[model samples]
Target: MSDEVVENDLIHCIYCNAGTVRFSEADMVSLLEKAREANSALGVTGMLLYEEGSFFQVLEGPAESVDALYEKIFRDKRHRRITKIIRESIEARNFSEWTMGYAGVTRQDLKEIEGLNDFFYTKKCFTELDPGRAKKLLEAFKDGNWRASLR
Candidate 1:
């Protein structure tokens, strides 16, 4: 690949975190609006899923932009116990159509994801999830295998 091609290569980061406080529907709407605006400006694309009081997000963009955004998320007071699950270069964005796609997950929606039985039964927070399982959840969302309400 040319230097320019390599320089423009995309990278993706997947992470999960606990909410400091349970977010209301209004709060989620506001958060998604702001995220979409900011991610659009940064040329980032991703999906965000919230269930109970936990969050799972997949962010893809230029490496610097993704890293910077992840740092900002890491320091955000709204989240706690943040755990990064994946970070690697990608050939292209998996969520290029959305600046920030969002879904509010329910227990029923959790049951639809194949490998998340543990979460369904134990109510484990996303931050406590296994990395491989986290990736599967992301793929499920990407593939429209979820029935969660979207935003």
Candidate 2:
């Protein structure tokens, strides 16, 4: 028998999208370009969903790196009132293949993405968003996106 300890290197974080100026579709696309470049360099992977004027994003990666990235993102002027829905160590990455996945919200997606509708019609500041909801959304996004990528 051997005595060895393995470290947990994974983390998942979800945050609310708040700020005065809402990015247009083109603006968000440009933002995603920058994010993909930066995330690839930092070994980060995640998904960003934008709809109506709100955003729901899940970023996962090395704990330290993900924490750093989230700090920068939280301070970003384009967003505010960030509420962390989840933060825990994990065995694997849900979005291992994506540097930064982008999902521009459509009518059909409204019912699934947790904080979208509240942010859309009720002006919720991600107050009621929970970790379970966030996890489910991220997993579904990851699975569907990966499946589609394979085709």
Winning model by lDDT: 1
Model 2 bad stretches (over 4 Å):
1-8, 112-127, 144-151
Q: Score residue 51 of candidate 1 by CA lDDT.
A: 78
Top-TM-score structure, candidate number: 1
- Cα distance off (Å), candidate 2, residue 6: 10
Question: What local lDDT score does residue 39 receive in model 1, on the 0 to 100 scale?
Answer: 96
Q: Residue 25: error of model 2 in Å?
A: 2.4
- Per-model lDDT: 0.83, 0.70
Candidate 1, residue 103: CA error in Å?
0.4
Give the TM-scores of the predictions, in the order they appear: 0.88, 0.77
lDDT of 1 by residue, 1-151 (tens): 5553333668999998865569999998999989999999999999888878889899999999999999999999898899998999988777888898888777677876788876767866575777788877877877764623445
Name the regions of candidate 1 deviating beyond 4 angstroms.
Answer: 1-7, 147-149
Count of clashes in candidate 2: 1
How far residue 61's Cα lies from its native spot in candidate 1, in Å, is 0.7
Enumerate clash totals for all models, in the order shown: 0, 1
